[model samples]
Target: MSERYEYQPHRLLRQRVRDIPSGAEGVLMAVITEDVSPNGIPHWVDLAYIRNKSGREFTTAVGNIEPA
Candidate 1:
């Protein structure tokens, strides 16, 4: 089952980087902008408007995010 997340605008979140090889664990911090779930399951989020600690922003799947 997919986990449910309650996200609010501007809320800081920690996202895991699973796409990277080498099994190098990495976490990215970002602020929530809006829910981008296409099936209305809150499974995706838009972070393009928020930047990370390095001032980088992106949109990713909700499975990558966790409470910061």
Candidate 2:
């Protein structure tokens, strides 16, 4: 079973991306739950909007972020 995602504002995180440096740190601004399943069970996927030190922001899958 998939783990339930929690809203963790102000949490320090590291964005896991190919182009961005692994050491770059960011903050978890918000956790958004999007309902992707409309039929039976609700398929809620968690997404995170992060702001890096440079003030740049981007959204990615929750799995793309990790504790920093």
Candidate 3:
């Protein structure tokens, strides 16, 4: 079984990408707008649209998010 993470809507979460390039040293502070899960796994939350501090929103896989 794969590990799962639960994120709530309207919550602020610090996110960072795995295996970031050496020159890049930063993480994104975003707010969870919604939860997206294609599979019916109770503890699995797959995707979400997060709005960054700059007000830019993007979609990313849950596995790529590192909790801050």
List clash counts for every candidate, in order.
0, 0, 0
User: Model 3 over residues 1-68: C-alpha lDDT tens digits?
Assistant: 34344445433245543312222222444434343355764544445444555666566654454443
lDDT of each: 0.44, 0.61, 0.44
Best by lDDT: 2
Evaluation by TM-score, superior candidate among 1 and 2: 2
Clashing pairs in 3: none
lDDT per residue as tens, model 1, 1-68: 24443345433335544322232333554444464567876654444222345655555543444433
CA-RMSD of model 2: 6.4
Q: Give per-model TM-scores.
A: 0.27, 0.48, 0.33
Q: Write the per-residue lDDT of candidate 2 for residues 1-68, one digit (tens) a residue.
A: 36344555434434333213344557767767766676858788777777777889777776666666
User: What's the residue-level lDDT of 58 in candidate 1?
Assistant: 51
RMSD (Cα, Å) for all candidates, in order, is 8.3, 6.4, 7.8
Model 2, TM vs. native: 0.48
Query: Model 2 misses residue 23 by how many Å?
Result: 6.1
lDDT of model number 2: 0.61
